[model samples]
Target: MALSTNCWKYLVLTFNALFAMSAVVMFGVSGFLLYRLFVYRHFIGVNVEYPAILLLMMAIITCSVAWIGWRTAKSMHHFHIVLTGVLIFLVVAVQFSCFVWAMVVWDSVDIDIKNSMTSFFDVANEVNNPNSPESIRWDRLHVQKGSVPFSCCGQGPLDAKFKPYTADCSTLYQRGCAKPLHQYTRQQLLMVAMAALISSVLQK
Candidate 1:
């Protein structure tokens, strides 16, 4: 029975180490995405990067909590084991709450993107060249390796060429950047939540 318990403890530790590493990786990814969004924030309009920031914060918190879990998992001290369980429980609760909240607000994410894109299109139409910052940013997103804009069929019947500041709804990709970005963020949060759940189970 003692040997079996030791084996189970080590198994949990292995899982904890994996979770800790994943949290670290998530932290880096969220930070990078936040940076990218910040760079193009002027054209994207208000509150565009807020979700990314939230994710980054979550990642940071997970990393810290995961580290504690890992350390406790490796330690045989009775107090450490009890403390680890409590900490894992708290983290799991907090993470789940945040995840659900984020999902609830996620429905409006597309609307915000639409609003931002509308503003972007209005400004882009007014400019003839990529001379303006907003226009340049708009062009930058669609710019390919050969400096050509990749045209996509939008809602309009006619497809518009994505060139400099001339890209309108017709010229932009049917799947807007915002949709994919928001989806990816949502998925990331889900992944984090799953990881947290697994960690909680392992703690038990």
Candidate 2:
């Protein structure tokens, strides 16, 4: 079926509106992630941050693209239309790149988190100076972050003790946080994947 000029214009406007909304959504999500990492950057490495920053940039570009799309819909100017098309392509490209980058970071960070947690536990156990740089950070992670109540001292019940530094000492949890944290990371990756699919398919 052939569409009239009015139908095409309406379609473009509708898509532009949706695109703008997606930009806002991406901005919120990426901004939140960036804020979280900024707070706990000491605990988690900055590797995952690259994708998040890229997503933030993508959101900004997407907003520009959507604005251009909206104006192009009204004026139907050749140059504006061409610019909007190019910007749309750029948005999708950046989104897909970020998705791949996120997955790669996820794979590496999961393992690194466990080892890092173990080291933090070790640090908390060995280091007597509570005010030391490492101790301060781990203390916040342990007691403040509820790391102790959340899980056991080590990987297992008989593994070792994570005491002295921590205030809690009555009982310990046998389950380590690695599996649970891994699941959470998987969930985040799933969200990224879904967003990438929506952005690529619908936007394209």
Candidate 3:
């Protein structure tokens, strides 16, 4: 049986509200990711921020469209509803592009991350001379970040011993930073998929 127009409108409104909440979450997470990237660019690699910026842009757009969807749901104006649909279509396209880009990045992120870590590892290994650049940077990171070395990432992994002229996997974290990065990206993709699925369901 066909749902009454009012019922359909209410249902769409609910979906829009949920999607707006998702946008809020995405905005907050993306903003935090951007800050982390800025602070740890040396170790994380500067290029990683490109996708984050795009995600932020998409979050902003989604917020605006969700607001429009809310208004359309209430007014149920034919033209406005059509406009909202178009907006959703655009968002879906953007989400697809993001998902694809994320997948591509995911494929090679480990290699890229390991390459970036190599330099930092060298610095950690050479952290004996107080005046040396590597020592200074290494000390600054440990003192400033206060994260578990080899066990933590973001800004760079800290070695457990922190002894000068020494490096070993025994003290370094076994799990690579790529795992968390991949997890976060996968979450973002899942959110996009959920939004698209919700929109499709609402249309029916």
Candidate 4:
């Protein structure tokens, strides 16, 4: 299907806008995380090296891709079919990788939460013995951990009975709970996949 010039223009505009928005989101998230790392040295701990760098790199790459797409939109025939195929493949690969990364991070965070909870439970049980002052400290620590909810979902442990956490976590946990984070991550990945698929179809 040969898209009209006007339609192509609109597609380019839309694509550029989406990429710009994504860039902003990436920077914002990464900036906040970096700030947290600065303020609370151990907030996310030593494992924090990848996410910030990845977000910044993604923003840069998205901007570059958007620029290329915008510039090429007006001269679609200038590129050979093989080149177009390569671009399409890259787009799909990038989006898929992003989806996988999000899933992995989400899963990691979930595991951390679970481990923390388990430790809290153990400490709570030990502290409840009534004979140790350490028990009081353990109870306090348990309360603190329970009070702290997963940052991604913004739902505290107290709210774990709610919809997204209850339903989404179940599916995510069943999916090996290793790299995949949450159902939301899956949804985001699907959106990226759909965008790439649609763009490829339209280009054809």
Candidate of highest TM-score: 2
Superposed Cα deviation of residue 20, candidate 3 (Å): 0.6
Candidate 2, residues 111-173: lDDT per residue as tens digits?
666666677667766876756777676655555444563333334333356533552345554
- For candidate 2, the per-residue lDDT at 57 reads 84
Top candidate, metric lDDT: 2
- What residue pairs clash in candidate 2, if any at all? none
Deviation in Å, model 3, residue 130 alpha carbon: 5.5
lDDT of 3 by residue, 70-168 (tens): 999998899998998898878767766665665566556556656666777677676656566665554455444442333233343355565344445
Better of 1 and 4 by TM-score: 1
TM-score, cand. 2 vs. native: 0.69
Question: Positional deviation of 123 in candidate 2, in angstroms?
Answer: 8.2
lDDT of 4: 0.47
Candidate number with the higher TM-score (1 or 3): 3
What RMSD does each model have against the real structure? Answer: 7.8, 6.9, 8.2, 13.1
Please estimate how well model 2 matches the true structure, expressed as its whole-model Cα lDDT: 0.71
TM-score list, all predictions? 0.53, 0.69, 0.56, 0.41
By descending lDDT, how would the candidates be arranged?
2, 3, 1, 4
Better of 1 and 3 by lDDT: 3
